[model samples]
Target: MEYIGSRVINASRATIANILADIRRLPEWNPAILSVTAIDPRVLVGKPYSIRAKLPGSPTIIYEQVSTDYVVWHLDGLQAHETGAWKLVSLADQKTEVTHTITHSGAIFRMLAGAFRTVPGLRLDRLQRRAEFGQERAGREN
Candidate 1:
């Protein structure tokens, strides 16, 4: 099962790219991510990193991530096993588009994620929140 999400931030691609380049800033905008840490070489293409997160009301879990321009997170669980990606695409007129996609490979995964399939909606909400936060942060620094 492949779940895809995309959003356009009301900001320049350069600004968005700068934020994307810094994985440590995720908590400021990513609602689903409770916290992120650079356990290895940090956010560099072709490098490996580890991240720990608290999934809503669930216990904290750790996942392995590999960065390659596009980053992929491999998550393991009793009911669901999947891979998720964060991709950045720059458009003309200083626009930036970010797409987040997830694909589940395990049998129990679909059943488990059925209730959580509302991710696309959640992402849309987070997109607006993140854009506002980014805009304000950028304004303050300028």
Candidate 2:
């Protein structure tokens, strides 16, 4: 199963990219993420990170970094390894297009994946809303 979501933040691509690159700030933008701990504090492109997040049922979910720019947490180990990404693209003028993509693969995931497809998109929506709210708050402060 593959799912994609995009959002336009009032901030620049650089700002959005910086937010995405910092694992620690995920909870501020991503509602599903409660805490993110970089197993290795390095900012290398392929570094591994560990994330502890809250799921729909209030259960904590632990996920591990799989490869470059990808993290996989087993929804049911036997069912699927959930893959997700954040891609920032510079658009015309001063706009930035942020795309979040997720893919689930496995026999069990295929059977039950549709039930979870809405999750990634909803998370991305929350992130975008947070960004917009931050921008509005900053504007008011100035």
Per-residue lDDT tens digits for candidate 2, residues 1-142, read 7888777756666555555555666677666567766553323454444555543322222344333234333332333455666666667543667777777776655777577667767876766665555653366459
TM-scores for all predictions: 0.61, 0.63
The positional error of residue 88 in candidate 2, measured at the CA in angstroms, is: 2.4
lDDT of 1: 0.56
CA error at residue 96 for candidate 1, angstroms: 2.6
Question: What does candidate 1's lDDT look like per residue over 1-142, in tens digits?
Answer: 8788788765554455455446666556555566665543235554444344433223222334433235565655445565767676666554557677877765575556565566655754665566546564567569
Clash pairs, candidate 1, are: none
Consecutive 10-residue window with the lowest summed lDDT within model 2:
54-63
The 10 consecutive residues of candidate 1 with the worst lDDT sum are 54-63
